[model samples]
Target: MANTTVPEVFATETPEATVEIDAGAGKHVEPMLWGLAPYQWVSISMLVLLLFAFFGAKVHKTIAGGLDGKIAAIKQQLDEAKQLRAEAEALRKEYADKIAGAEKDAEAMLENAQHEADAILEKAEADSKAMVERRKRMAEDKIAAAEREAVEDVRNRAALAATSASRKLIGEKHDAEADKALADKVIAGI
Candidate 1:
């Protein structure tokens, strides 16, 4: 009964009497309902329902907590992945910039080498021209010296031949008295 307690019903019972319910006791006895009285059935059903509710709430709380923790972990991992991706992109950009700078430097160095080669070639050409001019002047000077020596030799030979012919003519044509007079005159002029 709603208003009765289990202890009161057992306290009023006779030890030698069979258990019986009065019509006014508000206790319904189902005939052999799985060997359980109606009150027992109600009590068992309520107890089962209560147990189910208590365990179900605990299980739900546990499942929800686990799901929340997993979600937090997943979010953290996603954030870390994003950060790593950003760093990788920055590193890639930095390397690209360095490569671009190196390429530019290489181009500049190549141009400088070409200019230096051109300058060296020009200097060599100028030096060769100067050497050629110096050689030409030396050859001309040698030729002039040989010409002067030849002219002096020819003049000396001509003067010697003229002296010899004059001596032979004077010896053949002049007498001893004329030769003596001429010698005296040549000595006076000398």
Candidate 2:
């Protein structure tokens, strides 16, 4: 029979001492404190800091008050914007009504102008007709007067010719015998 001895795999002299084992790779160990891992300790530290800030500094109250002030200011601005929008809408409606009224006034003016133009045209036509009629009457009167004057002149000339012819006949044919015979005839008739 051969004699052999076995080596202790795990041995520690203190509770705080870290254990090491040889694997095929290099040593890899995570540090610890109070039975917690490093990551756990960091998380606990962050939580304590938050608690201290909330209780000792009243940080939550200050944050809440600041947020409330900001919200109130935003609400006031919103209300002012709403009031301005309402005023703008009212102004737009007023202008629209004015434009409608202006359109109506323009239409009325056009109608009146058209009526006046028509009336003027009618008056002008009547005046022209009256003027033509008056001119025609005057021309007719002038023609009638000219005709009467010509007739009177012809009659006067005819009377003069007849008197001259009668005088010539009396001078040529009338002698002492004609004179005596006319006197005897006239005395017998009387």
The number of the candidate with the highest lDDT is 2
On residues 1-190, what C-alpha lDDT tens digit does candidate 1 reach at each position? 5877566343332333334556895854334355565678889999999998999899999999999999999999999999999999999999999999999999999999999999999999999999999999888888888888888888788778877887888778878999899899999999
* TM-score for each model: 0.50, 0.47
lDDT values, one for every candidate? 0.84, 0.86
lDDT of 1 at 36: 61
What's the residue-level lDDT of 44 in candidate 2?
A: 94
User: What lDDT is obtained when candidate 1 is compared to the true structure?
Assistant: 0.84
Model 2 clash count equals 0
Candidate 2 lDDT score at position 65: 88
- 1-190 in candidate 2: lDDT tens per residue? 6667786555223446444546769875455555676678889999998889768567778888899999999999999999999999999999999999999999999999999999999999999999999999989989989888889888888889988999899989999899999999999999
RMSD of candidate 2 to the true fold? Answer: 10.5
